[model samples]
Target chain A: RMDQGEKKLSSVDRTPLHTEYVKSKLNLEGKDEVRKLKLFMKYIGVYGADARISGFSGYICELLIINMGDFHRTIEAFAAMRGKLVIGDPENTESFDSPAIVIDPTDKTRNAAAAISVENLSRMKLCSRLYLNGKMPEYVQSNGQRKDAKDRGTNLRVFRIKKPDIMDDILYPQVMRFKNAIWEIMERNDLRPVSWEVCVKDHIDVIIESENKAVPALKIHQGPPVDEPSSLDFYNKWINMKISRGPYILGDRIYVDLIRQQKSIGDVVREGLKKVNIGKNIDDQKEAMEIFDPYDTGKDSCALDLFLSKFIFRAHPPEKTSRNTRSS
Target chain B: RMDQGEKKLSSVDRTPLHTEYVKSKLNLEGKDEVRKLKLFMKYIGVYGADARISGFSGYICELLIINMGDFHRTIEAFAAMRGKLVIGDPENTESFDSPAIVIDPTDKTRNAAAAISVENLSRMKLCSRLYLNGKMPEYVQSNGQRKDAKDRGTNLRVFRIKKPDIMDDILYPQVMRFKNAIWEIMERNDLRPVSWEVCVKDHIDVIIESENKAVPALKIHQGPPVDEPSSLDFYNKWINMKISRGPYILGDRIYVDLIRQQKSIGDVVREGLKKVNIGKNIDDQKEAMEIFDPYDTGKDSCALDLFLSKFIFRAHPPEKTSRNTRSS
Candidate 1:
């Protein structure tokens, strides 16, 4: 049933023969240690193979527990790890490249931690270190209370697009691609998006906090090098054209100050969306996209939680003011 | 008379002993070929050893005329040359490094074209090519007429400073250094300077035309990478600080949007002058510096001439409208 394409696997597929194969391969004969560790991984939000989670699946947790011997050792291993981390047979490990790599015990060709993203892997290391250092509560315990978005006084642009009827596997990646497209557009226009987050549920919500909402009226436009044949073309094009300053040489190149066509960030994004390759499903529904200020829009609790937990709160370790006070 | 540093050289310094030595070494047996070439070089503004000129000295022209056999051949050689051009004995040419090199016939230790700048060398090449191609009159002839400063409609900033009682060699370099310092200041404050010129006679005039007279209010400030130990310090510093947008993550690094202190080009230049090394003499009289719009200031004919001859007109070859018409 599992081998048949589009056929949903039921309890009939889970035979004693398959269970025995998994038990023998992972060396999990009588112990419930891996099961308890999987529960803890689930609690910490690093327990899914889905695109949205990009974390440890149940099988990966089982493999890690068996490889490391216990939960404490696994946490310690992750906390100590830096850069790329690879586990399993040397030959199998060489084949996989990611922030965290765990080769499958049963299948040497498959990477067990393939779903884990660099950001999620980084988060795991951070959280492990925090738990070990006795500062886990500040991060792990989500109280669901955060400072008002307006109180932060940040230049937040919240974009809401109607969610396309697609599977979670397909939809989340498209949402991320669309978010990155918007980021590229913002960067190209010099809007300077500092931080951004994407939350997908009933509607796809993208929150981008930028340096400025508008670009300056005049922008420097660099031309070809003076020695190049095309420099004459550049000179002729801008000489009669309306410019703020140049048609002037700086070093070996020519430059001009042309009046910027699109000044506002909103206009840049709206105009740029048509040019960039935003995932096809999202692109089809881009016409109905609504841009709003953080305060103006009806706030999504999930988006606010993600902004706080993933970005704002997790950006730094708790300040050592208490330690300073004790020492004083 | 020439041996005494304070005493100016006269005809007494030009004794038969020195004349015989020059004529013998340069192979000038009563021929006026080098003299005629020197006069032509002077006409095209490439015949001076002063810092203001930075062109071929009279002696360098004579050496070149002897080395290349005539003025036409010398111009042809310069037109054909690319990158660094070295003339004279292969042994002596290795010691001197410049855009154009001519080893002294009498003194192999000294470079004859040492004062010739990269710009002057480029001008020589351009003028030579134009002269050869029969486009000499367009560049070489000075009719003492140009468009009015107001008619061009460029953002021209003219600054006049009282000239210190100093030699031409000392004053010109200092004036150039001051102009470069102002250019650096403008660039640092995000005011894009396109072209600049300095004219020092009774008064030192520095003109810089820029992309804008002011910078934007908000500017992006990059911080430490997230993995680095200083990132926490960066986060703490900007968390409560008055900023426009961030203290947020981009890739592995952190960034913020801070308010720009100095906006106007004048304020940036004035404040920056105190910090930079704009030559000692100019720095002493920086307080007396007067910045003005091109329309507001009384236009100097010499400055206007230079603006037209070197930068404005010489920036590009004349439009090929006639060529297109003939071809059509």
Candidate 2:
């Protein structure tokens, strides 16, 4: 590496600090058990050099092994794990926001498992639990996409958004933001999604499961209080409308419950997207925004897998496995 | 009335302090301008004593007149008021909560308007605004029931509970409680009620106007988190159920989106009511839960007025001007 005289050049093929830290963390015998297990877990899903999975890194596996003292113990902790997983909170949780938090013992500033995504963490957790329960799901051992929820009587939809030409680090967060924005928009429209997941890879796919796959005809619109100057504007626009139920005061505000113009989830998204700026990738992708219905076949096979892995077979053992799921 | 010997026995028809307070507060002309306006407001709706309205006493009228310096100003204040109304906090708001707050200058410990209900306050505010705006709604000057939302393309329902055999104060609060309880329950069931009013008159009428008079079949059921011990129990209950969906992990808890048994609002309320001990008044009122569909006329004419008063014509000065007078 060359540098100007003002900025002196220095080079070391391998840093002593990082090498020492990695070596000490890998106390397991043989040719690194952490690396082997991580490789073995990779075949089942999206896990490679540039996979979208957040957690389950080789270094994180090493740290987890060191923290649990063994591979079996690490898997056992995962099997027994319910909600949160905190591994060595050196600073005692000053600010940690991730599915799993594993603070680096060697360097307090670093977090070994901080990059792990909820999808990956839950997948690993579920796999561990299933392996321990002896009813191991075949998806972990074998590979390929997830199964369809065809006969499941579910209202699930998946939108595969094309990734931008930006860097992965920059693109991942944007995808997440877009996912959350859509979730919030859907909720406001009364689609009330029960489960949702966003995966960023070759493409950014947002999958959501909701109660009302369709939309209702009516929605209540809250206006400014009756005494405000703005209330007059609100009254003038809605009061005389045949669709408006009210131009009356309730509590402090004037409200009108009227018929919805677009009463479908698809219509809402199609129209709602046009209102936001939503960056280049989403805006530029010509054939983007592919909606795969729960029963859709062929092209939706992989989406079905991601949705199932993230929602249904989520690797976490099912809690309610036997009785009636619906209310009577 | 005679008091105990330990306290004191007095024969003062009117206390000197109260008389002095009223006199000093009434800065307007001869025959008590506040009294005349208060009496006029009473004839139209629930303002009269033992009528449907709650709060707005003669003492409160006196305080309002003193605060505004005259009847016109008091009415102007109401007309211009939008949301919250707070008056004369000589001590700068030492915690007060009411629909409207009028601090009694004479007795600093009391809030003369503390007993005011949101319904009565909003009615007065709307009426005042309309009267001042010269769009004096006829309902403000007449006495009758409400109207229907049949032509409005809206969904509204009314539940008129027979008042429990109790005193005025006791029964009124209970009616309010029942109204609030039903409102919350309906909201939980996704029947978003925009306007609701409770009137305890010939019958304890609890009228409600909502967006979803009918119910949806689908409902999302939330379960314990993936790590909880009960989560396994929850799993055991629903995993094999014919009606179940994902029972998936989202964030910390397990959730399942499934179909509800009663897909109609009326059915849910009827069956839901049977499950809880919703007091005897509601329990004993046979044929009490009458379904008054706006378009269904034979049984809706009477309900229309109640629903209209409690919801629609609430503020647009009552157009119909002549009927029986309660207070003159």
Listed per model in order, the count of residue pairs whose N, CA or C atoms clash below 3 Å is: 0, 30
Two-chain DockQ for each candidate model:
0.13, 0.29
Q: In model 1, what are the clashing residue pairs, if there are any?
A: none
TM-score of chain B of 2: 0.69
**Model 1 over residues A79-192: C-alpha lDDT tens digits?**
777666689888778867777788755556666688887656655665565567665443332223334445443467877888888888888888899899999888877676
DockQ of 2: 0.29
Model 2, residue A147: what's the lDDT? 37
What class would a CAPRI assessor give candidate 1's docking?
incorrect
- For candidate 2, report its TM-score: 0.72
Cα error of candidate 2 at position B275, Å:
3.9
TM-score attained by model 1: 0.68
* lDDT tens readout by residue for model 2, A75-166: 78887886557877546444576677777565554455666666566656665665566644344311222233543434677777777778
